[model samples]
Target chain A: MLIHFHVNGKACAVDAAPDEKLLDTLREKLQITSVKRGCENGDCGACTVLLDGRPVASCIFLTVKARNHSIQTIEAFGEPGHLHPLQEKFRAHGAFQCGFCAPGVTLSAISLLNQNPTPTEEEVRRAISGNLCRCSGYVQIVEAIMDYVEERRAAREEL
Target chain B: MAAMIYPHDSCGVSGATSVFLKVDSDGSAVLYSGLSDVGQGSKTALSQLAAEILGIPMDKITFIAGDTHTTPYDEGTGASRTTFFCGHCVKEACEKARTQLFEAAGRMLGVPSPEKFYIQDGVIYLKTFPECHVSVAEAAHASERIYGHPILASATFSSFSTPADPETGHALMFERHTFGTQIAEVDVDIDTGEIDVLKLAAVHSCGTVINPNLVEGQIYGGVHMGLGQALMEEMLEREDGSVVSNTFSEYHILTAADMPGVMLSGMVERPVEDGPFGAGGMSEGAPSPTAPAVGNAVADALGIRFTSLPLTPERILTALKAKQSSQRS
Candidate 1:
């Protein structure tokens, strides 16, 4: 099946198998390695990708179901020398260790911020509950996201 | 809860790890080691050790993990020995390469003795005359081209331990040990047997900490793992060799929603001898005390002692019912 989708804001068409997951289509076909293959049963959330700006587990999502959808991966978040503020916050806060689950967690956090920019700590925790990070225990990760939110609030107040 | 871990093989035998350090012409260094960083940041910590000895920025050092063709033989990372044993190996290799680099810089600066030179930010300067300096890159280039000796070294750090006595089974199983203490506070509902860990505080004396951020991260992560072991994280199996709850959804790890609201962590640096920059193994010890601490908290909350792991609701409810029945009878 040839599926047409916009990935990272770029129109791409991939010849994917009917049974292939969106994770396979993005990683194997589109050459996007940020979406990791972890717990392919959609429990770990390591393969989270944004479908129409909402986070979804790409591993269980069928590639054919993604036709005409606007998908976003971590590659769309930032690039070298020009990191997203969340990435910068993650670095400053030491939010990750091995970082296998970082991309999906970051995407989940991004989706949360997009929906609720001023979420409470509990909301932040609930938002990223789908992603599993074996390292850092989600302490620094939550701190980073909250810090990012505070910075954004401060910046907006100043503006 | 308090605990101590020996930084060696538990069977009263020495453990070993190896590393190869190569300083390039650009003053950049690459550390090839068979030891890998499995989310504990051992490679970064090792690179920090090398960079500190070589007087180069950490960014200038590239760490390659477990390359069979390039890296030397290592026993791998375990028992929190990566920083303790492999770290010493990295320091030894860096020191050897630093000696060669200083000698090359001494020759380039017209100094008689390499000991008279000091390195700072990849620049080697004469201690007597500070203005007389040479870049490590320049000296390394000259050492490779003109002197025919590139600054590179390989080191193997090994620990020795005496086997247990044949009669009493008493022996020095480790030369160094890491100690930690953890406190866990939990809220348990007597009816539902649901446990909610309210807070976790941990303090560790793991000699000199190589990286404080990574150490704290390990403590937090350890608490999560410990919490799972205490309250959840069980492998269920059906009869006739069938496995259930094998996936993450069924086999639950600590998620953000399940995390305790307050996590307090601290480090105690004693700086033991023979360690790389007086650092000790802290990663493995981080999770040791957590399970016991949570268990003690649960025991304190409910006036009963549960022996087995994963104090699930069913077990807790059964224990409570049994206690009630015993009291009534």
Candidate 2:
């Protein structure tokens, strides 16, 4: 079967199996490696991707289910030498170790910020709760998200 | 609330490792180490050690790690030994490379002795005449092109230990040791047998801190792992002995939502005599005391001495009911 989806704002069409997961299609067919292959079940959010600007576990999500919807991966955030503010904050706050869960965690946090620009610490924790990070715990991850929120708030105040 | 202490960095596996450093004519340096950074940022920490010794910016240093073909042999990156054992190896290699660069700079400056030179921010200068100096790039170029010597060095480090006695089961183990303490505060419901950890605080002595952020990162991560063992991580099996809780859904680990609202961490730096920059292995110790601290908290809350792990709700409820029956009898 063939599926058409906009990935990172670029229109793409790829052949996928009828029962293929969006995770394998994106990784194998589209060659988007940022969408890591973790627990293929919906439990571990390592395969999370933004579908219509909301985070979803692509591992269990069928490729056919994402035929027309736009998908976003960590590549959409920013390229090398031009990182998103959130990415910069994550680096500064030491939010990750190993970085296997970074893409899903980052997208989840991004989706939360897209809806609520100023999320509380608890809210931030809840946002990336599905994305499990074995390293650094969730302390720095929460700190990074809150720090990004604060920076944006400060910037808006200056405006 | 309860307090507990524990130790980490098992055995002396990290003690046997080596690293290689190469300084190019462009003044950029490359570090090769067998240590792997699974996520704990040991590569960055090792690079920082090299940069500090070489007097170069972090960006100028390219770190290549865990490459079996190109890099030298290493004992691997576990037991929290990368920062201590591999750190010393990187330090030694960088120091040797620094000496070579100083010699080349000394020859270029007509200095009689290389000992009269020192490096600062990638620039080598004469101790007597500070003005007589050259950039690391210039010295490296002169040494490689003119003197026909490429600036490179390698070092191996090992922590001492003796095999256990077969008869007595006694032996000197682990050359270095790290210590830490953790405190956990929890609220337990007697009826529901649910435990909510309100806060967690930790203090550690890991000798000198190579990287504060990475250290904190390790502690936070270690505590999270320990919490899973304390509260809910379990594996089930059938009568035939096949695993049941094999997947993430069945075998649960702590997620972000499970973290305590207040997680505080502190470090106590007491330099090790023979450690690299007075730093020792710090990562393994953080997780050791977390389970004990939490278990103690639950014990204190119910005035019960629990000897087993997880302290699952069913176990708590069973213990409570047994206590009630005993009191009634």
Candidate 3:
């Protein structure tokens, strides 16, 4: 089957199996190694990606369902030497350890910040509830997000 | 079941690790080692050690880790030994390079003795005449040009020794020992048997802290893993030996919402004479006491004693019901 989707702001068309998951299409076909395959049941959230601005687990999301939709991965956020605010904060705060779950966790944070630019600590925790990080214990992850939110708000006030 | 605290210590054993250092003519250094950084920040921590000892900025050092063909042998990156064992090797290698650079710099400046010179921030200067100095790049270039070899040094560390007592095995089982304590505060519902951990406090003594941020990151990660083992994680096997609960959804780990409301951590820095920068192994120690601490907290909440793991709602409800029935009878 042929599926057409915009990945990382680039138009991509690939041939995939009928039962192939979007994770496979992204990783195997498009060679987006950042979309890891931690748990194929949409549980670990290691393969989270933005589908039309909503975070979805790519492991269970079928490639066929993503036709004509805009998909985003961690690669879309920032390039080498240029990092997104969330990525920058995550690095600064030491929010990641093993980094196996980084791309998914980063995308989930992006989704949360996109919807609610300003979120309380509890709200931030709830927003990333679906994503599981085993390495950093989520403390620094939450702190990084909160710091990013505060910095953005401060920038807005200056404007 | 009893609201008792269990205190324990574990030995850290690291054996025969090697690190290779090569100083380029440009004053930059490359470190090659078999240690792998599985998100534990060994690269950053090890590089920091090299930079600090070599008197160069961290960015001036490049680390090549876990390469079999290029790097030397390592026992692997577990048992919290990367920082303790590999750290010593990296430090020694860098120290050797520093000594070599000082020797070359002394000759370049026409100084009689290398002791008259000291290095700071990649510059080797004479104590008496500070203005007469040589950059690390210049020293390396002069040494390689004269000696006909790149400035290179390597060190291997083997701290583990064989146990003397054959039966009891009492002879220095580990190279170092680390101590820690973890306390968990939980809110339990008698009816639903649900437990919500409100907060957690962890106090650890892991010798010297190389990086405070990395240490805290390790503690948080360790606590989270311990929570999973205490309240939710389990591996089930059938009568035929078929395993279940193999997936993350079925084998649940703590999510962001499930984490404690507050997590506080503290460190005690008692430098070990042999440890790198007075730092001992701490990565594995963080998860050791969390489960028991949470268990004891649950026992405190309910006077009833439950000796099983996970403290799942089903088990908690069953225990409560048993207690009620026994009371009625």
How much TM-score does chain B earn in each model? 0.94, 0.95, 0.93
Better of 2 and 3 by lDDT: 2
Report the Cα lDDT for candidate 1.
Answer: 0.86
- Give a tens-digit lDDT track for model 1, residues B169-212: 98877767777888888898888988888988989887888888
Question: Chain A structural similarity (TM-score) per candidate?
Answer: 0.98, 0.97, 0.97
- In the range A1-159, model 1's lDDT, one tens digit per residue, is 788989999998888888999999888878899999999999999999999999999999999999999999998988779999899999888889888999999999999999989999999999899999888789999999999999899999998
Relative to the true structure, candidate 1 has a C-alpha RMSD (angstroms) of 1.9
Model 1 clash pairs? none
Clashing pairs in 2: A98-B39
Per-candidate local distance difference test: 0.86, 0.87, 0.86
lDDT of 2 by residue, B50-90 (tens): 88988889999998988879888887777677777888889
State in Å the error of residue B220, model 1. Answer: 1.3
TM-score of each: 0.95, 0.96, 0.95
The DockQ values of the predictions, listed in order, are 0.83, 0.89, 0.87
Query: Model 1, stretches more than 4 Å misplaced?
Result: A15-19, B1-14
In lDDT terms, which candidate is top?
2
**Model 2, stretches more than 4 Å misplaced?**
B1-15, B165-169
- Greater DockQ among 1 and 3 belongs to 3
> Candidate 3 lDDT, tens digit per residue, A24-63?
9988888898999887888888899999989999999999
Clashing pairs in model 3, backbone N/Cα/C closer than 3 A: A97-B39, A98-B39, B208-B278
Candidate 1 CAPRI classification by DockQ: high
